[model samples]
Target: MNQPITNAEKLSKLPWSIGSNALVNVFVQLTFLGSVFILFLNTLGLDKSQIGFLLSLVPYTGLIALFIAPLIARYGYKRTFVHFSVLRLLFAALLLLTPWVVSNFGAEATLLFITVVVTLFSITRSIVVTAYYPWAQEYIPKSIQGKYSATNNLFTTLAGFLAVTLAGFVLDLTTGLTGYLVLIIIGVLCGAVAVWGVTKVPGGAPVEVGRGVMASFRDTIAALGDKGLLFFLAGVGLITLATVPLTSFVPLFLQEEVGLSSGNVVLVQTGVLLGGLVSTYLWGWTSDRYGSRPIMLSGICLLALLPIFFMLMPRYSPVSLYVALGIAFLQGIADMGWVIGSTRSLFVSIVPPEKRSEYTALYFACVGVFGGTSQLLAGQVVQLSSGVSGSFYFFVVDAYTPLFLLSIIFAIASLFTLRTVRSDTQVTVEEFAGMFLRGNPLSAMTSLVGYHFAQDESRVVAMTERLGVTRSPFTVDELLEVLADPRFNVRFEAIISIARTRPDPRLTQALIDVFNGTELALSNIAAWALGRVGDQTAIEALRQGLNSKYHSIQANSARALGRLGDAKTAPLLLERLQNEPDIGLQMAYASALGNLRAKEATSPILHLLHDIQNEGARRELALALARLVGDEGHFIHLYREARADFGTATAQAVSAFKRKIEKVLNSETKVLSTLGACADNLARDQLTEGAGYLAQLIEVLPADHYDPH
Candidate 1:
């Protein structure tokens, strides 16, 4: 009875649908799949086996959809999807009753209650899952599916981050039923929003059917005979086997074994969401350009390292928390790549569109059966090995250690299975890694900045901060090479870092080249670095930059020229100052004149000072006047103007100005004395203002302030 949705209308509503789906995922992660749920159950004294059994039940519940899928096709994908999705709102409300059930009926009854509620939630979710994707395929055009999926992932990750962070903070603050109840309320609200979003999406036609459910199952089984699908399934099966133990026990290990605070545990889990947020686009780009097989293999290889990191974690320390966080982040990256690559290569690219629903259903069924069995077995393994310990090779092994080792073995086997996967494009492992390191922006920048494998920019920036404090020549050399990186921000950071160290000719030339480059922002930053380097050789290049069409380049060049203190460039600086229209550039010229102490610049500087209205320029002109004539009154005027113009920056600027004044006073005492005598004669005892100002300056100047070294 529903009107058919036109393709154009479907496209129009696609973004809203994706956004709403992301909101639903946030609620799911916070309540069902998240650590908070596990922690809440742990608080109820439900041990590893019980928790694992509950988790295993989630995937196994997917079998219910085997019966429901036929009904879904007979009824309608959209109608069935909306009906069950709205029904999920009831489960959200039912979750609020858990604390009350635990209080009245004891842990055993609470567990039974939770099991029934969650099983229903999972079954409804399974039907919705079966319908949702096919419904999406009907509306989304094939060409933009990749982009749409990536955007959906981004939104989902961002939403999960918010949900986890908020839930963690709430649980940290509250110790009782109130926190869990509040989270349930939030989940219900988000569920309602998700249902509303689904209503906005147009409905698709119900699929036509002639055969029974048995024929559909036979067709799905027959489709699995494809070699590529079999190989892909083998790889996914191994990965799921490896990850089952981790998914079941890692949260338990962190909270129970490591004794990490709940807040810290949530922080570690949030790292996975953060990593996914960052890497989804990169994986998408790599899959499109290089081929999904390379990405899949690469992801598997990274995943293989996770068990090793787990093995290396200390029993109880802050360092162990960080290591676990690192493991979670790596897991996120690997999982994202694996999902995108497998979905694109194994599911979409390989299966015929007509058979997609059946094949996809069969795929989930295989994963669920194998993955659920692994979880149950892993739970038994953990239960049997409780308090068991031994020595393996040189390292001590414990009950949880075998699980990680098993994961490693399974992960390595998945790589072998992955070798059998067929794709339209192919590359060797070495070539794939090379292309990723060279072509990906973050990867290339990280390698260039330092050899950090994680490719985190903050780590590189932190290294830059330690340059002066640590004084490592090797590190400085590596940072210098970063100056030529294609990313402008990285190059700018490198320049700033290098400027903090002692000057070198290599660094000077690098700054010179950047100053001459076409990027105006970098050019301006390079000018500042050259000035900080105090390299006289760069003066000519900086002088040329003064003629640049960009005002920032000219202003920065003039400031750098002043920092070099070359008196020979005074006339040119003076000429630029008179002709310059921009008030900020004029301030740079005046400050430069002060740095150079060019007596010949006095007339033009004084003329411009009278006409300048900008407070910053007026302050700079006062400093220039004091530097030119050695007048104490000019210093006082400069301090007052600086204090008035810059509110919070005023104190620091004034202190720096005072230091500059002291330096000049100590170095040029004879010149200052001569100027004071000349000022006395010019005033001729009428005002005696010059003598009074000189006396006040001498009184205020600290006698021991100058270091004699």
Candidate 2:
């Protein structure tokens, strides 16, 4: 369910989607896949491996949708989803009869009944899930996919929290089959509500899908072979392989190794839900504005740490409970980041819009396959490592230790695959982590979440100013959003604030796009922002900007190109300055030429210096000549002193610089000697010792030339 702030229609339906998600999670978190389900099964004399098989079977059974997708696509994903969701709900209700089946049929027969019931339910649910993605993809607007996912997660996680808490209380009060039966009834009721909510949202009509089943198969084949898509899937698969085990076994590890009571373990597990609730919006917002790859990488990194933490966690103590809760909270954050990033990245980064159905099928199937295999693999490890008790340098090892070790290894491998997966984002995982590490993490999260609260111009300006003041890379998303605000003053301030952060491709491109805009003020400031960012990618755009009709735009573009040091445009600057009639614009072009150290520009600037009537403009041309010939300090001193007293050390420095220009024009025999002199003069500035002063002069503009006040 997408709740795009600007889309009124989508906003109106947001509650239905969120409510539906909450209901579904309530059902899920109580009966079938929830902790209550596992505990109930365990009390029935089922072993861990058998429990893992049942849990793993849910995702594994999703493979049935692969062959039936064309039918689902032809019949309409929404209609099929709603129809099957109802059927699945009915099947979920049958679990209420499990106690009777056990009493009548004996233990062997009971497992068969449960298995058959769950298998059928899983098949129908798989169809609903597989069809749901393309439908959801069509239903949700692309811009808010991350927000939509995160927001839905928030509601669903909250509902799950209540459902799990209820189940915990019910089981505590009523033991054996009666407690599970009550839980199943509640789950069934929640499922009914979930099914009702799904009908409220629009768009799930049948698409004009491929004609044959072979079409989906062909697409799947192509997806598996395509290097880029395949590599991304590989990354996703490795990550899935790494993380599925943690959710499956970590609770068991806490109970067995950490010496937490079953009741305390449930409370400890609430931390995961809390963590997810806290981070849901922030991760979604970040992914939507930024990209999902970094979030995914960050999730992997966080998951990679848990194994070590688990190993070092003190056992059988009050502190162990808190420690386990802290680790579970981190796991919750990792879970949100992983799911939101991986799933959203599928649509935005991996899949083509037209091929959403085709790609979504492959994406889910990849996760399903890896997810199923990971469960079985993790179960085998846990079983095999049952005798793995030992101690190594303060770290405790147990049957659960191998699962943690495997998780760590798989997480590390997933990172390498992440690096290979091509993404449009230029930011590395390290940079994204560093943003939080270096800046105020709490401030960054609060500002990002509150970004949309700025409804009026005043609030918008205040938020934009905060972003600029914080100067964190984490604030770049808000800055990008603000840069597009309809309010002129808001956009203006955003550009200025963007100048304060490190140069980013997204920010650089936004500035370049604004630079090419028709708005006079915005385009001018955009030019200045690009110069401040100093990204070479904007050089061509700035060069195009030099042709703008507004004098301010032209001057700012010329100066920006100089700041960017696009030396290729120095000759162009010289030509524009030579033909320019505007005094201020001439000064700007001269400044650019000077900054570029255009040796040929030295002679032309010297020739134009005497003809310039305004004393300020004349001195500007002389300064340009000084820079072009590699004399910065002297010209700066002379340019300032000439207003008070022209004949002194300042005069001598100006004269010496002028003598080099004289050789370039009139003395052919001394041209090489003067060239040597210019080279020698420029050498001192090779590391740009006086470059700051030069920049100071260019940025200020000739106040006498432009500002009447």
Candidate 3:
């Protein structure tokens, strides 16, 4: 009795899902997710290692999710998510009691209480999050998932920015644990609003039942067998380890190392959220079409440099605060790509709908293990490096610098794994990186934006034409995207534009798709365009296109094969020429044979020329013969003159024409190019200054075919 949700209904349910995420992001920002919670733990006299374990608890909760996933399958994803969200919030409210416990029970006892409470909250939150992923898979249609990820990030980031800005001032206004109390209270209230929003969104019914613990275990094992999913997880896990530590510790570095106030330290996080707010959508938009692999790799590479930047910042210099803010902002932008790429790669390439719940649980566990371990290690590293401070060459060494350098090394090491992950888009890492570097950035940006938002087919065609004229590699993706337009004119224009660019293998593949597609108009253009842009890879497709029942398609494909000029296809062209009944296709095959330099077809073509009654077909045959023998292209024009009458011409004009043929007959040279033959036979500049040969050419025209008025 399960009914499929129509795409329209799914779209209608999106606002609740995204809006709820935005609200929860505020709660996350104000509470344990960022600076406030870390500073709160630090306020209770807890050292680095103790605070690290607290942060680690978030991921440790994922271990429980491994067991709780089947419950979601039995009860339905949305219900479990809604129910657990409230339960998690109740536990989160216990965080408000931290200062009271610390005031009476001492640091050790307060640490124990906070751990127990946060762990319970984290466990509930993990189950809620595990259910949310499968819920999202159903709630958001595949067509818009890329945009939705970006949109969700955008709104959540704005909410986080606002929350941090508010929390920063609240901490500045009140002293110590009291400010922390206010923030937690606000966070819990926001959490309540977020839980209500989760109830309004639809989908996430139980995918199936009776797939018990053993089946879930098998699914987890089976996921590792998928090379794409495995490699993706490896790349993401390494990156998470590399980047998470820096984000976790940056606030502490600012507060303890650089002399920023608690409020200003919290406000610095706003820079990170602000950077994400600006750039997250861009990462999503590009990765949606360009493939997430580049986005993922590019992000981690950017992140790799940030740790080094942090290592070099002068502690407590006048500009150190500004420097800290800049690095935090840059980290946000770099991390946005990682976030978008990871989320998109999971939905777009890694997990499938049928296995959503189980795979999601595996994802949570994998990320949690990596992230939790990184935080714990980072804290321990901070604790261990406390005595290990000095200057390393030009850099100012501190307890934090070692952790930053460690993050940098791991960030770079993850590159190899990212490269191994497959990309659906054909763009290589070099090409994606070079796209803005080498091309006209404005033109590339304009083309991408115009093509993405283009509603008018005419405007799209115009943009397609302009992009072709730019001949930039960056424009090829947009041009290829246009080839899928439902309107034939738009697709036809895209094919022509693609042909005008430098040869790319993707161009050949895309053209092959259109040539093989059902539309004949696009098929013909795609065939012709393929010959212009395709490599040897395109020969097979063009050859197969010759088998199409439509003469226009066959003719274009044959002509394209000729244009491609691969001599290996000459035999196929000759066979088609000999058997095709259509005069148009016959001409096309003959032309293709000539371009391919198929010397074997010359005699057969001559026989066809002698037998065929059509003038145009015979002309094509003559040209084909000329090409095979390495004669000048102008030989076709000479053949026309010879067929015309010279009976009424003066003796000198007739004599000159006769002399041209006699010289060619006696020439020692075996091959003749067009200009070389023209110079030898006519005036030296006969092709350019036709005035010298105009009289001679006119005199040779048949008296029956020509008359001067």
Candidate 4:
């Protein structure tokens, strides 16, 4: 019996598996997969029906994978994957015989020969896929599976991008069967190297041979009875059905209708792969952090927009290529999200590990059957409506337009079905959508500007200058109109922009309303914005926010109260500081106390500073101490420590510390000037113990930077 594989041993084999997988993907994309392959068939004078039929052969033949799973179980994953992979390479080499077949037997015979070769290749490839997934599950630890999947996708995209780009250039230069044959030769070589890579990976344990074919078939049937699994299958099935027209017909549409050259077609396809390449890591991060459900929903929603973009591309127009390319790039990103999200949902969360091979085979069979049939049906839809045109409202509903419209309907249905997918981790659709939107760079920037700076502060001042230079300002009432915008980020940005210009009572109440809203992140930003507006009426509301249960609300409320500079709230801040054990919350209280210039806080601040060991909390305490004491020593120590830490750290860490130091030294002009004044006083009075440190700090400072007045 084989020794049971530990997680560590499995993890050690991931690099080999991932590398082999990427190499195989490159071979497929370059030779018989992707838009390039469809374009190749088009060049041979194959109609939509023939091209779709050829494309569907791969998935339709994948049904054989259900029976192949048992063979893989007996043979072992590594042995089966490696053996079939080597056989698939020989089938790829047979593509070079296509030109010879056409010369001797005519185009119809050539098509038949090509079909036989591809069918074998497809069936062999499907067996490899069946064995590969279970192998990966055993090899890659679940703890880092999302990250590992992302990395694997990254390699695949990079390889695909390079391979496809080269094939496009070759096809553009040669423009005949010769160029395609050369691509096939290259693909076969890649497959050979990929097989060698696979050989390096550790072979997982084989299943017991005593389990007969009937037993395996029964296992697969039982696995399909799972309701959660059924819902997941339905969701994936809808998406695959929706996208059939896209995968099967879009390349034909682009070349025939959009009138793009082979070079431009490759460029558009490359753009899509580029989009996937860029977003693979981001999708992985999101999947790992938030769970796969939100990523799936977000991807489906984005995918629903692709058909609309496709519909917008005008036939035979110069702009159509650009529009098609843009659509392809966006489609790539959406597709990647779908791939990553669905993989996690299906392999990691939904199916049981013991029966993973059986369930994986079953899942692929469903996709292959449904998705393959959809492609064939879509081909007939195109052929039946070939010359058809009509008006749907003001827009023309052409034959192609109907397919896209059908795709849109199915995409929406997939989104709803995905909501019912049960996973170990659950995120509500609403919360997931909100999190994704709020995490956008524009939204995050707007919130940063709103919460962190006063109206006349330099960052806000610079922003106003840019706004004035580039665009007209919204009138107060116009800004108010935007305050009720549907997107929370939009409304949040509008409220912040309005607060910068005019802090009216109505605007103050609007900010208060947002602060009391259900979106906790937005509510925290609103509280901080209320402080920046400095409305006395809002101060009471801000105080009420301090009593909220959420730590963020309490922290932001403290920071806001400090910005209001209310001496009366000093006692309350001091009490909170004494009780608050969270170091970050303690830092907020310390900053608030300093802003209030509460002398009562001095001893507690010093005590907290001495007791705290967290670097961030220490920096905040030092800044607060400087603000309270008008002492140069605190800032001097902070600056020195930041510099010393910067020297020994990585480049990224150095840059971060440098930014933090600059924010302190520059953003707080009043604090820096006060520190300078205290330094001068101590030096002039010859207070020897403290004066020496002050003088050294002054020597390091730029001249004429501090104005005591």
The lDDT for every candidate, in the order shown, is 0.73, 0.78, 0.79, 0.77
Q: What C-alpha lDDT, on a 0 to 100 scale, does residue 386 get in candidate 2?
A: 83
Which pairs clash in model 1? Answer: none
The superposed Cα distance between candidate 2 and the true structure at residue 131, in angstroms, equals: 2.1
**In terms of lDDT, which candidate is strongest?**
3
TM-score of 4: 0.65
TM-score to true structure, per model:
0.61, 0.71, 0.71, 0.65
**Which 10 residues in a row give candidate 2 its minimum summed lDDT?**
700-709
Clashes of 2: 1
Q: What CA RMSD would candidate 1 show?
A: 15.2
Candidate 3 — which residues are off by over 4 angstroms?
Answer: 211-232, 421-427, 456-462, 469-474, 481-502, 505-709
lDDT per residue for candidate 1 within 620-653, as digits (tens), equals 7877777776564757754666455433233343
Candidate 3 lDDT, tens digit per residue, 1-709?
Answer: 7898899888887888888999999887777788988888888888999888889999877876677788787889988988888898888888888768878998789989999998897888888888888888887887776788889989999999999999999999998688988888899899899989878887778766677877777777677888877877787788878887877888898888887888989998988898888888778877887888788777888899997888788777888778888988988898898888878778877888778877888888888989899999999999999887788798878898889888877887788887887666776667778866654656766777777777898988888887776767767777777877878788888889888877777777898888898877788888888888757788888878778888898889888888888677777777877787877887788888888777777766777788888776776777777787667555755665545632222223434554664565445232222223334444332333433344444454345543221
Show the lowest summed lDDT stretch of 10 residues, model 3.
668-677
Model 2, TM vs. native? 0.71
